[model samples]
Target: MADKPTVTIIGLGSMGQALASAYLEAGHRTTVWNRTPAKADDLVARGATRAATVSDAVWASDLVVLCVLDYAAVDELLAPNADVLKDRVVVNLTNGRPDQARRTGEWATAQGAEYLDGGIMAIPSMIGTPEAFILYSGSRTAFERYEAALRVLAEPKFVGTDAGLAALNDLALLSGMYGTLAGARHATALVGPERAAEFTTSLLIPWLQAMANILAPSSAEREAGDREAGDLPSEESPLDMQAAGLANIIEASRSAGVGVDLLTHLLTPMRDIIAAGEGDVLTDLVEVIGKEIRS
Candidate 1:
């Protein structure tokens, strides 16, 4: 059998440690470094090498994985070792804006390294698990070459050759996740503390799961291509109906002394759609949002 590729992890934060552990457990020769130094002790004891400096770490492996504090820290660490980065594949999994990812990708390329900007969709504990998936964008060739070793960390999704795509999708998914959480919090508040647990466990979870299944297809269709602005499906729940329902929910929440801020975001767009006298479907709100975003 071919030997597993060597890996050098250049951060020792929770996610970085998890990445190093995954590679080490998969029988790869792993080298780890962190600014604190002591963070590499555990991995070093598990048959991994402890790099004395960032240069040593970069020079130790063909695949260099970075999960640092931010893009600025990434620059601070890699700049000094720029010469050692040549011919290596740098997988940056730092959290940052799309622009930052693209700029870092350019910097890595200028140093003669192949780059892959990564957006890890999992928490530290989920690394190497079936449920975890990390998005990758940039250098299709590099991704294809190191795909196997990368899989040791999580399921890798190659989004595109554009370095910014991974970060874009990452932030977009996070926005959706946070929006859902906000709605969940508002829902729980509406039900009062005594019933919150039961409501979430029994009603909210099942209802959300079912609604997600129904809504996903429509979302997918919209994303597949550019549709006419008014091309909304003739769904059962029209815009006026949804707007009225939302208005009532707001009123009820207000009367019950529960905050309606989260619910009002949806209501605002629905009201605009009704006032515009456009298509009547609830999905028509998508067009309203699209126009505002484009503007």
Candidate 2:
């Protein structure tokens, strides 16, 4: 391998462009390809090579990076070029699920490609900066080999050898993000459209940020609610407040004619758990979720 590796990038969207820039800045020889050639102009202007086709890009580099829309797009773009994929390290920074990652990894293995699934935890602006964190899973050697070039996207966190780990954690963090937005939507709707943005910027934003710190404490308390988990009994069980308050909030939203169906749906499973007499189980809410708590 040369002192600075050569990199080929597919998917020239905002995130892809950012990655390309980062790699170019780090002095890697960058070969870029986009579904539409126009998008590669800026990178080309910056001394990068623009490939006419996906196979050309893949064949030109030791590492082929993908930062496309999703796994579906990935499958569409690369599936036709399976013959060209042999003996290459394919790093997918596309968003997907654990199952998708594992399935895709298997497919890549069939093509004689070493697959590395990655989840980008940062927005486009943070790419290559210290603020971004990227999760990688698959071959440890692949992670180590491309660590320097990959650091352009974020701090590379090798999430173990499981190809599914990257996509799984990606889904996990997205759940929290969606939940936070869901709560924001609920709060903003409860307050009026005119006041919603103001409330989010002022009240709701800080409140949710506060939840970050208090959440760990309440998390423990929630776990204790599960008698099977042997939680210490407390006079003030949080379930009463949760069930009743959420019920009331939904009721209020209904009374005001605001659409709160989503929040109601999210809490429904939790409500069902509590009704099933798991009210004391703090972590019982995890059952409604798609993954276990990060803890």
Candidate 3:
């Protein structure tokens, strides 16, 4: 049989460990390192090598994957070892902002390392499963070279050449998730604890799935700058009507002894769009919200 590729994993947190485990399962020779060395005990026991220092880990393999806690932690760990990283492919899957990823990519490039910034869209438990999809950007050459190895960890998505693209897309997707969760929390609170689970499983999930169908086409329209094209305003929900309904939601939540904070926050943009008399196209609120953000 052909030999498997070698991979070094830095950071032995839950996600980091999962990454290492997946590489090992895929028959790769794995080297692992963590600030807390004891955290790597299990991996070492599973036939993986343990590196005593960050430089040792970097030198152990050409393909290095970092799943550290944050960009700050990544800097602290790798900043002093630039010399060891030369000609190496460093894939950083740390959760961070786009600017941070861009800065890190620049630093890595200066040190002669090929860098790929990644956003992991799954929890640790989902690593190595089809459900996990990893978004990567920067250093297309490095990505292509290591694509086979990366696929063992998750479904690999090469987003763009800009190092910040992955982080930007990651944060955007997360923002949507958090916004949806905030609305769900308010809904559950209004319904009370006893029926919250049932409501979510029975009503919210199916309703949101159907709403997702609308959002998919709406997003395409927004991207094409043709807000009037898809599912016209006459057939769609109106902003004035949505704002009025939000007011009712806020009032109802307060009456039910739950906080109206989330619903009230949502109403701000709707009110802004309504006052500007742009309520004719409900989706135009996206532009209104973006303008508010820029201001």
Native-referenced Cα lDDT, model 3? 0.88
Candidate 3 residue 139 C-alpha distance from true site, Å: 0.5
TM-score of each: 0.89, 0.85, 0.92
**Residues 1-295 of candidate 2: C-alpha lDDT, one tens digit per residue:** 3587799999999899999998888888999999999999999999999999998999999999999998899999889999998989999999988999999999998999999999999889988777889999998888898787787668999988999998888888888888888778878878999998788898888988776654444555566653333333334556546667778888899998888777676576677666777654444455555322321
Candidate maximizing TM-score: 3
Better of 1 and 3 by TM-score: 3
Tally clashing residue pairs in candidate 2: 8
Cα error of candidate 1 at position 119, Å: 0.7
Please provide, for model 1 over 3-72, each residue's C-alpha lDDT reduced to its tens digit, 9 standing for 90 to 100: 8888999999999999999988899989999999999899999988998989999999989999999988
The CA lDDT of each predicted structure is 0.88, 0.83, 0.88
Off by over 4 Å in 1: 218-233, 291-295
Each prediction's RMSD to truth: 3.5, 4.6, 2.9
By lDDT, the better pick of 1 and 2 is: 1
TM-score of model 2 (CA atoms)? 0.85
Residue lDDT tens for model 3, 11-100: 999999999999888889999999999999999999899999999999999799999999999999889999998999999999999999
Task: Sort the candidates on TM-score, descending order.
Answer: 3, 1, 2
